[model samples]
Target: FMNYVPDMQKNHFAKEPIMTPPSEVFVTQTIYADANGTFHFSLLKAGQWGFAALGIGEQKTYKGKALSQDAVIWVQATKLP
Candidate 1:
């Protein structure tokens, strides 16, 4: 995660970016980059998924037929071992 500065030497915010780990450590780690508005997981389940993110004042969910659909947040569950 990075910040955009109008006339600064580097692209770093005054405050460091906030990083939130997943609730359960055994499963996987969920990192959220607020500055970059992105997220990633340590592990991904290979199958169709229904995602929903709820925050203080935000709530969003998606139910796609397949994980490869053209959507904001869709995961293409590729066969893996």
Candidate 2:
């Protein structure tokens, strides 16, 4: 187990206790997409869950290549089937 060390920067910006960072902040599993660029995940026992995705890519144009960052998306979990 890792202990949380207080930080002035975070505490000042957040204006909250420089406390527990996050317990469930990391991914427990990774599901890779298939050749169809499609993938999925199972929630096991239905309950509220949260998910976030980040993607980056580069494209070539007539001039040069362009780099970009995809919009961050967060999906709140609901009852699952």
> How much is 30 displaced in model 1, in angstroms?
5.9
Point out the worst 10-residue segment of candidate 1 by lDDT: 64-73
Error of 2 at 13 (Å): 9.8
Model 1 Cα shift for residue 1 (angstroms): 26
Q: What pairs collide in candidate 1?
A: none
**Tens-digit lDDT track of model 2 for 16-42:** 433443555533445566666566866
lDDT of candidate model 1 versus the reference: 0.40
Residue-wise C-alpha lDDT for candidate 1, range 1-81, written one tens digit per residue:
112122366654555323433445633334455654566553343443333333523223346322322223435465676
lDDT of each: 0.40, 0.44
**Candidate topping TM-score:** 2
